[model samples]
Target: VMRANYRKILVPITEEAKKLKIFKGEPLDLNEVSNLNTIVEIRKLIKNNQAKIEYLVENKAKKKQAAIYLLTKTKVEYQEILKGLRKTAKKQQALLDNIVKKYHEYPKFGSKIVSELDVSSSVLRTAVKKGWLVKKEQEIYRDPLKDFESRKQKNQIKLNSEQTHALNSIGKSIQKKEAKTFLLEGITGSGKTEVYLHAISIALEQKRNALMLVPEISLTPQMVKQVKERFGDNVAVLHSGLSEGEKYDEWRRIRRGEAQVVVGARSAIFAPLKNIGLIVIDEEHESSYKQNDTPRYHARDVALLRSKFHKCPVVLGSATPSLASRARAQKGRYELLLLTKRANQKSLPKVDLIDLKTVEFTGAQFDLSIPLVDAIKEKIAKKEQVILLLNRRGFASFMLCRNCGFVLKCPNCDISLTLHKDTQQMQCHYCGHKEPIPRKCPKCQSEKIRFLGTGTQKVQEELEKLLPEAKILRMDVDTTRRKGSYKKILDGFGDHKADILLGTQMIAKGLDFPNVTLVGVINADTALSLPDFNSAEKTFDLLTQVSGRAGRAEKTGRVMIQTYNP
Candidate 1:
């Protein structure tokens, strides 16, 4: 009779929403909401018929569990079996004794002793066959917390008024289980990350995990260090840069509920985490969040769905947010949090633009203007570090012949070949095709060939020639292609081992160098002239972010932008 009545009733949900599998193969429970239209339509249909309706609300909570090995019986209970085995198994007594010793160490789980047994000796197989040993899978607690041996407890920071207000609002949502989205728009060095860490602490206090998405793998080392310093082994890092084995292990950690905090790039949004209390998208405006392939998913949108499902808060933080996010924030869709003041109370850096059309060239190289070179020299004389930004890599952009106006080009690509000075080869950045650096133009066969255009490699060479005593660490795709090279270069620069840090746009953001008082932009118009509308916006962001790296300490920083467009 109950089954017949259940078939007469109807409930429906959206296809995508139903994919969550919250309601399946049963009458809709009162705890779950059904569509109002469906309920109203069903009532009208049943009005003329003899039918009764009953509603019941029952709260059901289930504990999540994972498979773990446990002993079939206690070590004390196994003594009788060992006594029987000692008589029947004469040669297997040694292996049996070792297994007995291992059980004494970890009596709750027998799989812990599986590795200690040499199954090739046939003792463990014999014992299992004789009912002396049993392998049983049971529910076990998964503990993700691990002790970091050398980490020093960081001193607690006093939040400024602005940070305090943002924290209070964000924490309120968590405490009330209200799913909300916040756009944390702050200027460079305005303590956005500090707000994120503190909010994550609150989520942990609520006994929930947090998921943080960063844009690049290069940014992971610094972020992992910070989170580990705070939460230790409760954190798991995911990114393409990790080995397959490492990725699997980290995924298992999250799936088994061993990791309460997940920090990763785009793919991390889908981490197998349950009851996530918070989701953070650092640098939310970055284009990296948009997946270009099939099953296309944006990290921000995924965060929203996850937040809605778990009744948590999502924080989108960036100094320069994307237009779509900023527009949403302008509306009532997302709550906006602003951090206008610098955390350290330091003044913003001074910016100076040198018009390359009018400025004097330095040492016959058009790449470095005289004023910019003077500023670098001045900073080095004061023993302060410097960072030079040139978005291009390789030694020279192209090789050109003076006589016939012939240019070297890649065989497989329409783009010109780039000269790598260190490798003495012309490489195609697009297709990885490489050839010997030609002494003369291939088309004209003229010896009067010149390497034209500027790259980070060329800039580094010019700096070496001009500033002979300056220790320059060049970081780009070429220098940092090897694993751990990025961290090594940054660490060397942070330790004051290098006087100048030169790199491409990868060095533009997420780097804080206090001793760097001078930031020189060799070519500000590189991205500005691209055939894209957002070229101007990207150029502005790169300039602003790179300039923020300097003068972060007690020093006053200066920026000299050498540009043809002024």
Candidate 2:
């Protein structure tokens, strides 16, 4: 499997590279800096007739010529560090308790009680202690407050019948401490969160930990809130949006066992949860689960691997599973559990296509075609809300020179640069290359450079112009960059504060607006227009998902998807 190969390769590299201790290679020449006490142990552990190392590592170590050297600071036992901290935490907690009691008894005498527990000389010593923990500006504790939390947590929740069955089936097939992949094909409005919580409850019952992976930045908050509401402070959340120090703290929490359930975006899969029992990947089919950067790990795949390592289970929940995952389910590799009908048992949305080819417009170059505009007007007049989706974010897809038909393109990318009308600049969505839009086209000397194609900004602006009385809102990346933007927009949407929400793919997936009678896709062509093997799949999935968002409420919604080739 892809995971097995990575574990056999990356683990050795991670361990070896971090220690700078070369295995099956020559020792680092520490002769020049002669304070070296290098002890090279090259005893080849080969059992039976097989000539290989014991670690199941793919790179076989040479027997006679292997030069394995140990560095002075190579390995540190986790138990030793914990033992020391446990002692310190005991002392500190005792001191804090005594001080707290004294303050309660004599509120004014708190200063006097504090002086009694002071380590007067500690203020002078350890000014030069050079250690990883010290370098991180962390206090060396007997038992840190965070650590105490994990150790002292006692509340264990009981599972329901459905949850118990899920656990037992998954528990058996999952093989703990190894990779067990299970797809929980639950409905959007189903209690999949509760199922995940119950599985995690089982993990905690076994004294193992759990990691929940979310596929998007926007999804993290809601998931985190749900997990926190259930597990209290036993959760640590991580995402690309967090700062380095925030990530460091969350990592430490996992390592220290202070965090039992880690809710994060993708990378939470690699969380060093000592003995992981369950891994829950929400929105498993999401492309966000795949890492575009090097070490190209898929969080969902990694979670499956980690589950195998612990011989546990992995739950991949999505309304619409990817074809590959569905195929696996069909092959019996994954136990297919379906929560097909909506919890409320309402009908799914009625999807219709508005062929843009039949519509003719005179001065209209933006996203909304005549039929779509008519549909939006019809929905608004009926007192029902609408949602318009345009995948690309900026104000315009690209700037074009009317004189020579020259399209503005990014210097670093293989794509056209987007025109950010708000910023008066052209920005490369790929490399983030940005420059002010020239008054005259560089190549053609044409001042009449036109912003072409459609985007979220252009759609929102045109909608506002067309429907003057309608309260239209936009929720793409640019508008939601600030903290709490997703929540704020979601709240606004829930309250029906906006008549319509015009956005990119962010508004897709599992958002339900009961009053939203109409869901419109300005360009169905954008999704299918991709030049990839998964084009048809992407088109179908996106089209289906966006349609799913409409009729989630009792109103029995309608969706109008406009396509150029319709």
Model 1 agreement with the true structure over 141-169: per-residue lDDT tens digits: 33222222326758688899999999998
Give candidate 2 misplaced runs (Cα > 4 Å). 1-168, 171-179, 360-363, 369-371, 374-384, 512-515
The number of clashing residue pairs in model 1 is: 0
Across 268-377, the per-residue lDDT of candidate 2 in tens digits comes to 77777887778888778889888989989888767766666677778888877899999999999988876655655677777778777776542366456777778778
Query: Residue 170 CA error for candidate 1 (Å)?
Result: 1.6
**Position 188, candidate 1: lDDT:** 82
Worst 10 residues of 1 by lDDT: 1-10
User: TM-score per candidate, in order?
Assistant: 0.74, 0.69
| Index of the highest-lDDT prediction | 1
Residue 393, model 2, lDDT: 92
Off-target runs (Cα >4 Å) in candidate 1 are: 1-150, 293-296
Error of 1 at 541 (Å): 1.0
